[model samples]
Every structure is written in structure tokens, then in C-alpha cells.
Target: MSRKTALLLLPGLAFLLVGFLAPAVAMLLAPPGESAGTVVSRFTEMLTDPYELRIIGRTVLLALIVTVVCVALGLPIAYLLARSTSRWGGVLLAIAIFPLLLSNVVRTFGWLVVLGANGAIGRALTASGLTDDPPQLLYTPLAIVLGLTQLFLPLAVISCYSAVAQIDPGLDDAARGLGAGRARTFWTVVFPLALPGVVVAATLVFAGSVTAYTTPYLLGGSSQRMLATQLFSYASVSVDWSAAAATALIMTILVFLVSGLSSLAARKAATS
Candidate 1:
């Protein structure tokens, strides 16, 4: 390799080795002789636990739902931002980005106020006589999904907007000239071109959701335990560092698998 390239890579390599890799290795290594067996046993126990399995499944499900919702809601805004020539476009983009400036705790509390039993939605339902009482809006999977979606929607928007902005306007014009409608052109031309952004956005949201603790904990409640929460339980509450390491490794594997599949899908979409 070139000397300049090697020099450029040194800082990142050093940081990765010292900051992340060393700690990860320490976590995975149990002690001396018992490390291998202890690691295997911890993984086996975690795998066999029905409660843990449910948590894993629910985490994946919620992450997927959040990704989909973010794409659904963010794409149109992205498209508008990509296509707009007006002042309000920048204003709207700023508005969309405003939520991410707040801390996760602040955001979760905001959702709590909006989604609580006495919140606006519940009050509207009651005032309109839609029901006798406010439904359980907090501490549910839907609540977790909502919080996550709101939290990460900006990622999807920014990614998609950048991708959409890169597409040649001539393609859209050509598609339209060929008698394609607006929806048809987007499905055929714009969306396929923007698949890479969607993939990136989805992977980011998925990884974030998998590792997230605060939003899920506060919004979904103590009952809604994801692998992250479970890992915290093992490491902090139970003081089981080995089990926590195993759980962290497993979650890492899950994220890799999902990200790999997403990349594969994006490649296929690009080619086909």
C-alpha cells in the first residue's frame, strides 16, 4: 500500500484496537482455562430461555416496524425536499431535523406526555365519545415503535433525500414523456435509484433499535425487554459479565446478518 494511505489509516486502526477491540476481547474472555466452556454454557442458557427468545423476537419485530414506518413517512418528505424549489422546503427540512437535537430522555418524556392516558389523543377520543375511557397507549409495543420511528425518522429522510437528489431530472422527465404517471415513474425510476439510501437508512435504524435502551425502557416499560435491556440486566443487575458479553456478541451477530441481507437486497435491486 502507499505510505500516505498507511499513515492515514493508522489513527483509526489504533483507536479501533485500543478503544473497541481490546475491551471486546476482554469481555469475551472469561478467565483462563474455563473461558471456552463458560462462554458456550452462557450462550446455550441464553438460547434456551423462552423469555429471552421472546425478547429477541419482539426486538426484531419492533425494529422492522420502525424501519418501515420511517421509510413510509420520511420518503415523501425526502422526495419533496429533493424536488422543491421553494423556501418552505428548507424550513420543512429544518423542522424534521429539530426532533433529533433533543436528548433521548427529553424525547421520550415528550412522547409520554403526548401518548399518556390524559394526553391529547386520549382526551380527543374521550371528548369525541369514541370510547368510555382512554385506551392503554403507553407501555405497549406500538408505543415503542412510535418512539423509535420518531427518533430515527430523520435518518431515513436525510439518506433518502441525498439519494433522491442525485438522480438525474432527465430520467423523471423521460419517464413522464413515455406516458408514465407520477406513481409509476417513482416506482420504476426514482425508487430503484434510491434503494441504496433506503438500505442504509433501514440498517441504521435496525442497528440503533437493537442497541437502544432508553426509548424502549421508558416507552415500552419494564415489561418490554429487548436484548439490550436483558444485557443490562445480566451485566448490571445480576453482575454476570460473561453472560452479558455473550448477549452482546449475539446481538452483534444479529445486526451483521440483517445488514448483510439488506446490502444483498440493495445490490439485487440495483442490478435488476
Candidate 2:
């Protein structure tokens, strides 16, 4: 309502319009010219395409798994960083975030080496009698999930740590002093306070996992296709920009619905 506030917001509004909205509009319109058939027909084709439908389903499944894995692993690391008093906590936090500083391709290649049939993990599993032979790790759903979890875990940790850090230390102290055990205090007090951050982290992880191109492409074989791979196939291989746009739009909607429902569910859980 204020002129000064409007002035301050103008740059951001301008950037959004120029950076996101314009390009998105262009892409959406690009698809309309692809076929002589109507847009409705293209939608039908996209929906009925069995391979693409499978890719969409698999992409959602993979993203959900990646989100769960990231949160499950990130919570303890975040708790440690949030509650620790030692210099090592900061050191460890930096180490946890260190992977994010590397090129995505580099990080993915690192996983490839570790998960390869001849890699250390595979050899160790075989040597330890965990398996009769080196398990087929790469080019599987397991490999993609692991790669995605590793790629996005830092975002989850940082989000959770920021949330956990915001809670009053005194609240935790009081809970413990009131005869609650450490685990009890965490569940009753700290974790509830950190729920919002957990939701944010989940959203980030899910969105990142679903939209990722390289990790899925490299770690997953032809059978383990995701939506990003499908999008790339359409755009590059088929040279169908319109179909690619449709895929992108579908992916955006999928990410939004999943994240929105997840955040809503988290809020409801927190309230009840």
C-alpha cells in the first residue's frame, strides 16, 4: 500500500516477470504449434503414452523415496549441528555441505565409482559375505535414489538445522528438567518446533529429485527412466519442443501437488 514498499518490491517483481514468467510462457506456447491436432489431442497423447505415463509414475516414486531418505538421514545430522557446543559441530556441518560446492556431474561421478560393481562398496559387501557376488548397484532404482539423496541431503540438513536452531534452548532445558528423557524431549518439543523446516526440506528434496537430469541419466539405465530423462528425450531426440513443454508443465504440476500436499499434511500433523 505504501509507495516506498512498492518501490522496494519493483526490482523483484520485474525480475520474476522477466526471468520466470516470460520464459515459462514462451515454452508453454511453443508446444501449441507442434501438431496440427488440437492441444486437447496432444494432452490425450501425452496421457495415453504408456511409456511416458510409466516414467511419470516412476519419477514421482523416486522423488518421494529420495525425500524420505534425505529427511531420515538429515535429521540426526541437523540435530547434532543444532545442539552441539563443540567446534567439531561447525566442522562437520561444513563437511556435510561440502558436496554441494562441487559440480553436480562430479558428485554423480563419485557415486558411480562407489556403487559400480567393481567399486569399494560392492567389493566390501562381497568380501563381508553380504552377497555371493557384487550386487548390481548402478543403473538401478537403488542407485538413483542413493545419488539423489546424497545430492539433496545437504539442503535438508541446512533447512532442519535452521529450524532446530530457532527453538529456545531453554525450552529443551526445561523439558529435560521436568523429567523427560532426551528422546522424549526431542519428540515432544524440539522436533515439533522443527517440523516446518522438515517440510521445507522435503519440498526441496522432492522438487530437486524430480527435476534432476544428470543423476538419473547417469546412474539409471534405459529401464529406470524418470520424467527429466523423458523431457530430454522429447526435446533433443524427437525435436518436439511442444511435447517437451507439455512434459515440463506436467512435471511442474506434479512437483507442486506433491509438495503442497506434503506441507499441508505436515501442518495438520503438527496441529494435532
Candidate 3:
């Protein structure tokens, strides 16, 4: 590279190191005034302890469920939107991602209202004679999953839309000409081409769901704690810096692992 190009990149690289990398490394290593051994021991405990294992398991399972649900729903919507020739296509695309403009807290609270004992769902159930009383739905895994799915669905849709839109519509016609059905064309052509985008969407949604604090805390409550809430308890409530650092490290590792796997899958799909 030219000296000018190297110099131009220097400032951005310096900023990235100082701004993000250094602090992230420090946090994963050990919290302030804590020994590396302390953090390591706590991390080991979290892995071995049944309580902590359950929280971690719950976090992972919920995240997987959310990712699958979002991808299953988002991919089809994105495909339809991308293939639409209607003038309303632009408007429909905008509407698909509109939830992103709303704050996460706001959307989560909307779920709170709907899932609450006296909320819409409960009221409807009672009015329909499906139940004699309002069922407790707020502080369950289901609530957390629903809230997270709503929170991340728009992101998945938009990511897949961008991916699908980049592919040539002519490819679909070409597949049809070769006597391939719509399902076969999509599986053999469109889906493979769009796999990278789907991977990106899934990675983002999984990471967000696993680390998300607001939705899980509010929806799952004290009864159904996830890793993020556990970390919060360690950091703020219990004042256990070592454990908090360990939790953060675990979350970071989980995200990185999923990202790596997703990248590998996308590359394989692209090549195949």
C-alpha cells in the first residue's frame, strides 16, 4: 500500500483500538482491582454450578428460538417484497422495517401491556370463554421470546431484504425456464444466493437476544432469569465484579462463536 493510504488508515485503526478493542480486552481479562484468578475461578463456577448453567441454558435456548422464528418469518416476507412489482413495494418494504425506528423499551412495554393479566390477550381469552381467569403470562419464557421476536423481527426482515434484493430477478425466470418449480428455484438459487444475508440476520438476532437486558428483565421477571439479567445481578445488585466480568466474557465468547459458525455456513453455501 502507498504511504498516503497507510497514513489515512492509521487514525481510524488507532481510534478503533483505543475506543473498543482495549476496553473489551480489559473487561474480558479482569475487572478493575480484581485478580485474573478471581475472574477465572468465578467463570469456572458459572460453568459448573447448576443455577448458573440453567440461566445460561435458558439464554441460549431462547436466543435460538428467536433466531429460527425470525428467519423463518423474515425470509419469506423479504422474498415476496423483493419480487413484488407493485408500486406499493417500496411502501411495504418501509413498513417491514418500521419497527426499528421505535425504541426497544417502547416495543417491550407494548408487549407488557398485551401480556399483562388484565391486558388484551387475557381479556380476549376470558371473553371467548377459553379461560375463567386471566392466566399469568408475563413472567415466563414465552413472554421473553415473544418480546425478543418482535424486537428483532424487523432487523431480520431488512437484512434478508437487502440480501435478496441484490440477486437478479432474472435468475428466477431462468430457473423456471429450466422446468424448475418455485420451491426448487428458491432452494437451489435464491436461498443460496441470499444465505449470507440470512446468516447476518441470524447472527445479529441471536447476539442481540442473548445480550438483551431490557426485554428479558421486564418480561421474564425474577422467576425466569437469563444470562443478561444474571450479569446485571452480579454487577449491580450483588456487587460481584469478578462474576460480572466472567459473565460478560461468556456472552462475548458465545456471540463470537455463533458469528464464526454463521460465516462458515455462508461461505459454504456460496461455494456450493
For model 1 the local lDDT of residue 20 reads 92
Measured by TM-score, how close is model 2 to the native structure? 0.91
CA lDDT for candidate 2: 0.87
User: How do these models rank on lDDT, best leading?
Assistant: 3, 2, 1
Candidate 2 per-residue C-alpha lDDT over 1-272 given as tens digits, one digit per residue, 9 for 90 to 100: 99999999999999999999987767755564664244335656888998778888899899999999999989878988889999788898999888889888999999889999899999999999999889889999999998898899999999899999998889989999999998999888988888888888998999999999999999997779898998898888988776787788788888889778877978886787
Local accuracy of candidate 3 as per-residue lDDT tens digits, 236-263: 9989899999999899999999999999
Summarize candidate 1's per-residue lDDT along 76-169 as a digit string, tens digits.
7898888888879889888878877889889888889989999988999999999989988999998999899888998889888888999998
Evaluate model 1: give its TM-score.
0.93
TM-score of each: 0.93, 0.91, 0.96
Which portions of model 2 miss their true places by more than 4 Å? 35-40, 126-133, 262-272
Residue 240 displacement in candidate 1 (angstroms):
2.0
Against the true structure, whose TM-score is highest? Answer: 3
